[model samples]
Target: MNYIDNDPRLQTGKPAGIDKISIWIHPFLIREPSAFHPSSGNNKKVILRYTSRNGFSIDFQAEFFDPFKNIFIQILEYLIGLSIRGILKSPINKDFSTVEKCFCTLFTDLFAIDCIEFYFDFMRGHLILSNITNQKYKTTRYSNNYTREGKSVIIAYDRIERLKYVNQMNYDEISSIIYPMRFEFKLNRTNCEYLHPTNIFGNYNVIFDNYLIFLAKRWRMYNQQVVSIPVLNNLYYAEKFKTIIQYSQWQFPYSMMNLEKTPSCPMPNKSVKLKDIDRNWAVQFSLKDWV
Candidate 1:
């Protein structure tokens, strides 16, 4: 039930995709007064919350990036439901009120992006060794945050486990997510513009595609340095890793990376002693393994 598209990620029991995204729409874009209750604070100082009848909510403020409810997640769910407001599916129904139509039209608007966070489930044999950015990484038990308060924050953490430990969750409350090790890259408006000069605001697929672009770029590099068989990992990342080769900096890693090491044990008694040498007894990796 997790992926109705028969997405192979279900096989891995992991969630891999855009984990979270935040954007700022021009305040005037949403003028439903009934939706914005009241606030005595000045326009610059006050934040307004908007909740649609269907339980969709987004907070608004005039600033580019404020702590107010800058998250608009319901749109992602809407896209998953096979609804793209007529772009990918069917056009908007004509029976809607003027306000509804106005809201629907802006779905195509070039968004003034605020923040986009990309994440994935990270299991064993993963190490974030990329030092391409000039910023120093802030290390914590749960995450490696690069560029804490700048154009972006590239962080890798197992927040699910962090929550379990921090909140002292019971076994039942603990999340069943395996290898919850996740990589999150949050880009501010400036970095977002750099990645996609044309801008990242478009349909849901477009937003997700940009995240894919980043994930692919990293996957290509990370695969090479990994200690495990790249193909086995590729098989693990069927949902998201396959596209990485599309942006491989150099040629993708060869199947040889998956070679197994089998070490012979010492003889049963003192009479014979086996050498400590490691034996790669299995078959060599085949080129087709990556296919």
Candidate 2:
């Protein structure tokens, strides 16, 4: 076997763009989440009403407006645009090595996160610039020779927060402020080989489950990951914690509002007639139920 081929580390990790990963994550994460949250009002519509940090209530809408605003997308646009524009006024793209250095430095400076976690997507000969911040994500192909049009959708989330629970605001409650914000990307499916087993913590298994529980109890989670709840199509990750006001996960359609038509019905059957409409009747059923 070839020397490079024989190495297991080489097999597990790709060498291309391994040196310049920070450039990738800084833009993609912000763009994708922006599309999901559009504007302040939209986030509120998506998220349930709740108070946090000094009587400030942020549904999905407010969270998108205030905090999760610019960390990634705007910065990426600036750097990439500078690269294309050859704008000497900007510090980046003075030289190839300096450009790479600028990307890494700027990325770490803005996100306060590590550069190694991002994976660069290469299609044909170009890099795919979607969902770069998410460590675990999938990519699809488009067109172009030097640049391949690619899209990425986030499968999971790794968020760092200051509260014992997610999105809670008690500055006095905060104890330690860790630098370079700690997080790992959540894959739609888990594979043991990629990460050290103990690193994952959550309701599902990956590696950091226990640590997540510890954080859940000790730190207030300022960061959040809202995705489609696997079992409940109409539900989101925050809707699940209905009983726990401090941190809510997996927001269901009914949880957000009381309505006649169930929030997430496959579509709607015009032929089917309804009488009294209550959310209780539409409890989310798992995939196994249909199977």
Candidate 3:
């Protein structure tokens, strides 16, 4: 999703009438050669390029939403998807309806969905919900472009060009050439519907708390397994960008949250079997083992 232009109306206490929905949703993939990429300008011939299932094919008119909105949507969606898969601990094949029901309940209750146009951001991520029924009342014109809070978060992905690795962050802090978002399914024009990946970050600490539990459990199951967010290699870096919380305490710049230590398995003490004068034999056997 792209930011088309800065509106003075936003300062004048008027609705910008600009679409900002793209800011919330980010797809799972980043398109090569960004919209502003030198090559992108040259390729603006208005030809019908087959839009990726998750990418937009609109002629980005200045009056229309900005191209940046497109990029923003793409990145936001990707982060959401990752959180669903990684944090919510949901499986991929779960029914879309069930996922949507759970998502709306959790997100709306937690973040106040009535005030936020997350679907627009989801669209940016190239995630299309098959059923738009849930999003019916949210499609206002200018309201789509701006949030009451002037500031917003962006999921700047890493290694989008090479691999699908990413780091969640605010827009101002991202430095790498990354896609704004990635979508789970390929784009389909006929249906024109999609849903975003379930995301965990953004103002909510519950996701972080849940992640800690998941991580600890996984670690307990297999201690040697590497616990990595890849992008969060160092605590200093995370602090600089204010990225997601790092699992390792040493890697966190601020006071990292501490998890309750897992209790150890208890060992049982043996009781003598009082059978047929077997006390002497049992004592002798136990003593031999100890010896």
Best by lDDT: 1
Give the least accurate 10-residue stretch of model 1, judged by summed lDDT. Answer: 282-291
Which candidate comes out best when scored by TM-score? 1
C-alpha lDDT of candidate 2 relative to the true structure: 0.25
TM-score for each model: 0.45, 0.18, 0.18
- State the TM-score for model 3: 0.18
Of candidates 3 and 1, the better by lDDT? 1
| Clash counts for all predictions | 3, 30, 58
For residue 228, model 1's alpha carbon misses the true position, in angstroms, by 9.6
What is the C-alpha lDDT profile of model 3 across 96-135, one tens digit per residue? 4544443343332111100111111111222222222223
Off by over 4 Å in 1: 1-14, 28-97, 104-111, 125-153, 165-169, 194-207, 214-234, 250-291
Q: Give the alpha carbon lDDT tens digit for every residue of 92-192 in model 1.
A: 34222422443343332312334455545555444342333223322222222324456324455445656565565566655664555555555554343
Taking the tens digit of each residue's C-alpha lDDT, what string does model 2 give over 1-291? 222223354332222111111121222112222232223333132231212211111121111211112323433444444444443122323444544444444332212211212221121212222333433222222111111222121122221232343455455534432211222222211111122111211111111222223222211222222222223222222221212223234333322321112112111221222232222211332212210
Error of 3 at 272 (Å): 60
Cα error, candidate 2, residue 291 (Å): 58
> Which portions of model 3 miss their true places by more than 4 Å?
1-158, 162-175, 178-203, 219-234, 239-291
